[model samples]
Target: MRLQQVLSLVRKAADDYEMIQDNDKIAVGISGGKDSLTLLHALNGLRRFYPKHFELHAVTVDLGFENLNLEEIKALCESLDVEYSVIHTDIAKIVFEERKESNPCSLCAKMRKGALNDAIKQAGYNKVAYAHHKDDVVETMLLSLIFEGRLHTFNPVTHLDRTGLTVIRPLIYMNEADVIGFVNKHQIPVVKSPCPMDGHTKREYIKNLLKQLNYENPGVKERMFTAIQNGNMKGWPVL
Candidate 1:
């Protein structure tokens, strides 16, 4: 996907959810992965022509992994003229070495988000942007259904009253395949995930399951996204 195409989808999600307000400061959570980097590019492009005047900042919570290099990410942010910040923490140690949780994704995510949220709040940003896309939405819904016995996924716009920060998903309308296409086409610097359990998780299982289901029954993913849009879920944009 081209930058224009990416911006179109991002603009639609932003407008539909009223995500960007004039003079609002929004931070994009950069995980150094393709999805977040795509989001950074989309939002940066959107800022050029978006009628609503908002600021974009790129933030990453460094999990204190030795092999995690962020120099390229910093250069990318510089090229895009977006301010970037990295919150250093020993989350990897706490979750893996110290706590030794069997299911470390949950605790690691909690710590990562906590660090990200604190940085956003301290920076005085009102909203933060996440990179959860269409595939993630479907996978999360399936995970909820299969495990928690509920048809639930994240909202495009979420208000974290506790933190006084609203979270927005500008890339919610984007597909993961398109994200890959865009990244590959533009040669975006995507840092490989340094986590030991990058693809070995329940979400990965559901992702494969959903892929198989879509293969057996074509367009199932799109239908699932449509259902989510019309499910009357709180914080979801009313279609």
Candidate 2:
């Protein structure tokens, strides 16, 4: 059932945004997390039955995270017979040293994203796929609205034409619960980050705060996801 849900979302995203090509090379961004692992697994499964031919490669960035098991992620990819690559960067050091005035998460994310793009480009892949799901999009929407004074969510599809690359989110239709369930059922090896401030971040706050609202209004996240899909968001600024 988990595989089915994941495949459905991937196919839907591909069809909805024309993300896949006849002979495309896709580099999947993996962070040793549930979402990224599940995405890699699902995409590999989809490749068997997809009408057009496409290659799947897994890319991970080592952000100088403590206790990071680069070998474990490489082993998982090898078990699936997918090519894997890791880029090492001391992002934690940079974040700690340079980011004193602004929020670290935003800057760290920018650097990580840039690293992913560099890996994708260096690997000769034309497109990069991330593991952002429905709940992530909804959370980002609320975070932007409440804090950034805007109504915005990550797009299901994005084209970086200048870089001659495209970014796609295949799990945009699946929720966090589904991903967690899938990961637990499979007992996939997940490498945990050793950030002492993991749960104290603003994103975590919003997640918990939203959970309270969701308790009072069931499917609040689902409703927000629907609004993003059905709303006339074409004219709105897209990131």
Candidate 3:
């Protein structure tokens, strides 16, 4: 039942948005975590039967984590038989030493995305896929509404001007729990976040708060997810 739900969501996103195409050389941004790894695995599952003859390659930005090996990511990609690349950036040091941000997740996220966008483009892949799931979209929507005074969420598919890249999120329909379950089932070796302050961030708090709300009112999040799925979001000026 769980697998059916996940595949349903993935297929809906692919069909609804026309994300993949024949002869597409897509770069999957791998962040060495469950979300990204789960995406990689899911895409691998669908690649052969995907309506289009597309290729999946894994790319990770080395943010200078201590004891981190680019080899693990390489091996993971090799095991999957997909091409891989590791672009280095001093993000960890920059966040701690230069920015000195108490809550660095926001800035760190932006920096890492920028780096990945640039790296992927340079590697000659115009289409890049990310592992941002449904929860990430909801959190982004909440963050924008509360902090930016706008109700906006990242689209499942978007074009980044800096890199001239078409960024797609194939896992936008699956939630974090589903991703974790898939990863555990497959025994995927995922790299932990290099951040020292992983769970203390404001987004984590929001995630926990949402979880509690979901517990109190079953289907609260599910209903919200359906709302997004049903709505004509493209008509919005924000997109």
Candidate 4:
């Protein structure tokens, strides 16, 4: 997708959820993946013309993996004129070597978010942006239903009472395919994940399963997304 198209969807989600406020500073959580990079580009473009002025700051929590690199990401941020920060931590060691948890994604995610949130709070930012898109929403809802026996997904906006930081999902309206298209068209520097279990996770399973289901039953994905929007779930934006 083009930058303009990406900005349109992001703007819609932000406006619908009342995400950005004037003079608000948003910290974009950059995982060095396509989704987060696309979000960075979208929000940077949006602030250029968005009525409610806001600032964008890029952040990444390094899991202390051997192959992880941030030089290119720093260059990208410099080109976009957005400040970037990377929090270094031994999360990989704690989760894999020390704790040796069978299901490491959960613990690793908690640690990563903890580090990210601490950095955001210390920097005095009020809100943080995550790059969860339409496909992620559907996949998460399916995961909850199949595992937890509930029909639920994340909200576009969430307030973390403990950290006193609000989280926003401006890319909630975007599809993963479009995100890939944007990254390819713009030649965005996407750093490959250094984690050992990058593609071997429950979410990856659900992603492929959803793809097959959509192929067999056309429009199922869109229908599911519509259901999420109209499901009247708590914390969902009422448009």
Candidates 1 and 2 compared by lDDT, better number: 1
lDDT of each structure? 0.95, 0.84, 0.79, 0.95
- Tens-place lDDT per residue, model 3, 46-100, is 8867677888888888888886756677788888898888888899899988989
Give me candidate 2's TM-score against the actual structure. Answer: 0.93
For model 1, where is the 10-residue window of minimal lDDT?
A: 230-239
- Ten contiguous residues with the weakest lDDT in model 4: 230-239
Question: lDDT score, residue 117, model 4?
Answer: 96
Candidate 3 Cα deviation (angstroms), residue 169: 0.7
TM-score of each: 0.99, 0.93, 0.90, 0.99
Mind giving the per-residue lDDT tens digits that candidate 2 earns over 119-214? 789778998999998878888888999999998888877888767888888888787888999899889898887655567787888888788888
Regions more than 4 Å wrong, model 1: none
Segments in model 4 whose C-alpha atoms lie over 4 Å from true places: none
Clashing pairs in 4: none
* Candidate 3 C-alpha error for residue 74, in Å: 2.5
How do the residues 53-86 of candidate 4 rate in per-residue lDDT, one tens digit apiece? 8988999999999899899999999999999999
Residue-level lDDT for 204 in candidate 2: 89
List pairs with backbone clashes in candidate 1.
none
